[model samples]
Target: MSCDNCETALENLYLFLDEEIDHASIDEIQAHIDSCSSCLTAYDLERVVKALVSRSCAEKAPEPLRERVLYSIRTVQVQITENRGI
Candidate 1:
């Protein structure tokens, strides 16, 4: 595959790894990764990183903490919107 095709494939590498895209796109990215060593290295790194993040985030937050964080975010959003006169 051409470098341009490899470039295009890398653009959606994460989606491919996550199985979030169409089969045709997955096939294209898979083919590109199989053929291009550089892209393959990048794909491997991205896959490893995603796996690490997923495992690290497997724990659920306590309900009270979660609610407080969401409340703080909403409060900030309201202040911002009010300042913007929206």
Candidate 2:
């Protein structure tokens, strides 16, 4: 079932999955899915990826690695501020 207007493209579909689309766009996508089998399949694949990312990031970061990364960012930020005399 193809959309009559073909308005729902994959990029907008990705934004919807990422919760970056506005409510009206979400409504539009829902309408598109109701009519377009191809876009619906694509949307399903994106949902699977979203769920997988949620699952994978559910685990805690290792302590040393987390601290090291945070420290590096802080170091860089402080250096930048010092350079700018801020």
Best by lDDT: 1
Q: For each candidate in turn, give its C-alpha RMSD to the true structure in angstroms.
A: 12.4, 14.5
Question: lDDT values of the candidates?
Answer: 0.67, 0.62
Model 2 bad stretches (over 4 Å): 1-7, 59-86
**Per-residue alpha-carbon lDDT of candidate 1 for residues 6-73, written as tens digits (9 for 90 to 100):** 54776788788889999998888898789876667667666655655566588755567556555654
Q: How accurate is candidate 2 locally (lDDT)?
A: 0.62
C-alpha TM-score for every candidate: 0.62, 0.57
Which lDDT tens digits does candidate 2 get at residues 1-86? 22343444555877888889799988887887777655665566557556655665987556775565556545544553444353
Top model number, TM-score: 1
Residue 27 alpha-carbon offset, candidate 1, angstroms: 0.7
Q: Superposing every Cα of model 2 onto the true structure, what RMSD results?
A: 14.5
